[model samples]
Target: MDHLADSQRVLTIGEGDGRFVAELVRRFPHIEVDCLEGSSAMIARARARLPSAAKVNFYHVDALNWEYPVEIYDAVVTCFFLDCFSDKTLREWLPRSINCSKPAGKWMVAEFREGVGGMERLRSRFWLRVMYLFFNWTTGLEAKQLPNWQGLLDELGYGCFEKSETSNAMIYSSVWQRWENARKTDGFNP
Candidate 1:
């Protein structure tokens, strides 16, 4: 939550077991999240495990169809989730992700990172591709290069405020803030 600019509304779009968002709320008691997840089991577990679940209301629904409540959140988070969509679905999800975020609000993403050459990296990438194809076909996710997340944020017109790659390069933690509610229709300035 320290990554957040200040005390404001926050929502976790693809909140899983609600673990990460839960942590966000824990540290910043003022932070609130309207967590949405498609999985019921995960949602139940998250509800049970979260210390701040009372503060963090949750909604169980598909991210693509769920209503975004019209510019209410100061931050939108899609951690380890967006990569599950196909380009078409990604396009849909992105706008909604943006919609949920208030003007000048932040968008944060935490994703698995395929590190540089090594047996570990090679194996991880191979499995990730296979998993993406399987899930993409099953769930209709894009499943391609969701890495280089900074690029993804830029391509969507969200400027990167700060980012960090895991020591093993196994994950990327990113925060991007939109300049305004309306995106440029093209992408980033650069």
Candidate 2:
């Protein structure tokens, strides 16, 4: 977080309960973070679990209609928050979020990328579909495949020059550095 220069203004789209978000604020005491979450319950909880650091701000906002500051962030991160939307909503958000992202900025997303073993696959699929039916309808998310995000970024002109994965490939995350001209010459050392 300290490495990010423009992260002085950081935003989390679905920042529920400030605990996890507070971790970032705690680490980067000088950096300011603004979190947007739709659930009042979650937001209240977040306000309570405040990080030790005082450089944090909170807002009750939805993922789709939330406003972005005129200045972009140096880094944006999503953890287990992207899979809840439908394909249409995902499509809309990808572009909007990419726009919110800064040039040469880092965007990281962590999500469940693969179905589980045999029977578990079927069960997970059923639950995944159910989640889409229930949550996406309310949240206005367009159902989408997890890996398709790479293509979405490419379509929006991000090359995803670096990436990483964990949990036996079932969970993955990638950091995309955006550009307006030539693609940025960036890659993760890891």
Candidate 3:
């Protein structure tokens, strides 16, 4: 949220139960937010959580397929959301996510990361596998493992301005800022 202190328009994908959105609306009264979530119940809960005067729009739509707003948002947030996608799906959707933001916009992500080594790596892998199985069975999620989101973000010309890890490197949060040169060289207007 600190990375987005100056943001005016924000987009949040998979804004689950609305805990984050509720606080975000309260803290940043001047900012407008568009929140996307697939579950109807979650959307209702999110709506109910927000204050009456909050400047927020809720969309009960799948993030992967929803039409992007096109280079308008000052910041894009996807907390614990991107891990649900396979590499193929991410390859298709990530660019759309980027294009939804302005040329020099901020992108914030928080999700599970594959651990580096030893016991930590084992623990991470085990839990991820369990999560994959459970989500696949329950929600029909496509990804069997965590996607290399950092790699894709780097390839798309985003620089990690801030990052932190916890749970023995099994979880990470990062703030990415898009580079001007990257957008120009890549011809990624809009």
Which candidate number has the best lDDT?
A: 3
Error of 1 at 43 (Å): 1.2
Tens digits of per-residue lDDT, candidate 1, 1-190, equal 5766474688887787868766777777777667889999989988887773357888989877886787788878888887665456666566665666666777778878676788878977887778777876786755665534455566777776566787767777876776453244233332
lDDT of 3 by residue, 1-190 (tens): 7667788999999999999888887888888999999999998988999889999998989788898978999999999888988888898889876889988888889999878889888988899899999999999988888988888998898877667899479789887777663344333332
lDDT of each: 0.71, 0.65, 0.85
- Which 10 consecutive positions of candidate 2 have the poorest summed lDDT? 181-190
Stretches of candidate 2 exceeding 4 Å from the true structure: 1-6, 115-147, 179-190
Candidate 2 lDDT, tens digit per residue, 5-81? Answer: 44776767677666667777666667777777888998888877775556667677776776675446767777767
lDDT of 1: 0.71
lDDT of 2 at 152: 71
TM-score for every candidate vs. truth? 0.77, 0.74, 0.90
Enumerate residue pairs that collide in model 3: none
> What global local distance difference test value does model 2 have?
0.65
